[model samples]
Target: MHELIAAPFLEDFLLLRPGHASGVKIRGHHYLELRSLAAEEGPLPGWLCRAAHRRWGLDLDAHGSTREVVLVREPSPYGHGRASYEVNNGCNWACPHCVYGDKRHEGLPWPQRAKLLHTLRDAGVVWLELGGGECTIDPHFADTYAYAHDLGMMVEILTNGSTLDRPQLLGLFTGRRPYRITLSVYGATETTFDGFTQRRGAYRKFRRGLAAAREAGLPLSLSVVVTEANAHEAPAMRALAERYADRVREYTHMSPTFTGGSDPLAQQAPDYLHHRTPFTGCDAGHTSLNVNPFGLATVCKISRDHPIPLLREGVAGLTRLGGIADQALRRHSGCTDCALQQSCTTCMPLVTLYRKAGAPLDRYCQHA
Candidate 1:
């Protein structure tokens, strides 16, 4: 049965209309090699894989699509780890759709931030995401970049690109791709940008900032958060993406599981959740640690309750959280039925967005 199910799925994926971009077997398994598939394509492969597994218990996509490079470190005690630090959680643009919104703006003082990086470096963190509402808003953005560089950690910043126009931003990546600057382009027009962020005339600043970052010879990754308002504008956005090939990553809105209120926080049913393509086993609880300025730690960024304190501790301590590393959070449910599940980032934070307690593998992930 396994062989029969897998054979057809492979054939179907291979026969996908535009044919395939690249195909080369690394070892024993076969992968339908391709460059990139949109969110719609994510679930198809995973759902078919699960059906094959259920019929005969075979995992077809054991070998994921090959990437241009590898970012994770080996010999990691926890089996996986994602590195990050709190540079500052304030932003220049006020995108109403932001999950963190004003909450992230309230951050730790300069002294605490100074110690935070040293602690992360001591733990052997390689890639540190300088995430926030926006890291570029800090007056010491360049210094922060230098600090991360000095610690021998590759830095990545999540920003709206309003400040990248500053010449100093280039110095960080002059000779090499020192850092990754992700510019979130909510809308191509000033009206849309201003409307979403509640700030007028933001499009101009973002465009200039992106040009500055590109001019600086820095690596740029565009993160587009698609919502109801901008769904129709996808084609234009895609054309915009074509301007910057292989550097853009668009994330469709994963049902609003957090308190990020756009315009007004209309009371929605807690059970009213939305599903995308594949169900991913988000090991953030096991793979990464997200700490706010207050020192409260949770598995993912949307956590609002049952928080663990990791201000003084490190990534290794995330496993020792009160409710983490439990059987409930060991896995999630419904993912096995997903077709694009293989490409999904199926983290619990992505699924359990309504604010739940304990990290049990059974809560959101349950393998069929």
Candidate 2:
């Protein structure tokens, strides 16, 4: 893995560390504007060296010059700088609140997966999030992650933290390091957690994984997921997460599945179902997208109506994405004439799911 990445981020250029979130935004031409700098083999430009030292306290000069630096020469044609990919739909735990109704342990083979990564890089994606039913358990997890990091994309992982404590995984993460590893906290106690996940010994594994990650000093974030099954232990869950992670987020709302299945909605805690803020607009298809394991690209995770077969057309398939996003974000037929349209907080794709599930109006609409 390259120690430093100098890549084009949208309209601006950035100097970023492999595992770190913060970066130095490159302004003015300096070394980056010079096309020859990318091809030349020598010490890194003095300006870049200085920027790295000032920003990350990195000694690029001592690191044996430009060969260690990964320089991106061209800008992205898709105009997208970030994306989230589901490496597989498989999970070790069967959580009731999972938005993906069906969990399948399947993904593209390594060869096709490599092609997808290159396509994402060529499309100018810098921040890539790898998720799944549990990405850590995927067969190609290690290779996919290392390849993405080598391709100059800062990788973030969303996982259940089950297999994180394994020696191989720990070694892999310790070596390459991810920009962030977000673990989903189901419950505080073994009974509550294992019961919630429908997997015995889940809580024990989670605790072990948490300890391993903290010991390794990996960048850690926690999502304290709140559902009816584990709502009673919410406080404990938050406390446990805070003990291990510096960054903790709470997820209270449970949405229907990506396929518009409402099975997961039954797990939503009534008290936690707060009103959503009005939907303004998003840059989902325009500036960001979501991809499934099969290389099907959609506007976002929820709006899966029009999926562009990325493997067939490659990045060119993304041309239809912006238009698809525009259509998917519009108000559904039921919501189109509603008087609360202005203050409605739920996006159209979500609203469509609620409508499909026959969800109570109060759950998503203002009038209810």
Error of 2 at 165 (Å): 0.9
The lDDT for every candidate, in the order shown, is 0.51, 0.86
lDDT tens per residue, model 1, 267-357: 2222322454554344554555566656566655654456665565654555564356343243355543656456554554445552232
Residue 298, candidate 2: alpha-carbon lDDT? 92
Ten residues in sequence with the least summed lDDT for candidate 1? 1-10
Off by over 4 Å in 1: 1-80, 257-277, 303-306, 313-316, 319-351, 355-368
lDDT of 2 by residue, 1-368 (tens): 47777777777888788789898887747435433566676666788778888888887776664755755536677788999999999999999899888999999999999999998888789999999789988899999999998888899999888888899998988899899999999999999999999999999999998899889999999999999999999999999999988899999988888787889889989998765677889989998999999999999998888799888999998989999999988876877788878888899988888888777877777877
The TM-score values for the models, in the order shown, are 0.63, 0.96
Q: How many residue pairs clash in each candidate?
A: 29, 2
What are the clashing pairs of model 2? 277-345, 278-345
Best by TM-score: 2
What's the TM for model 2?
A: 0.96
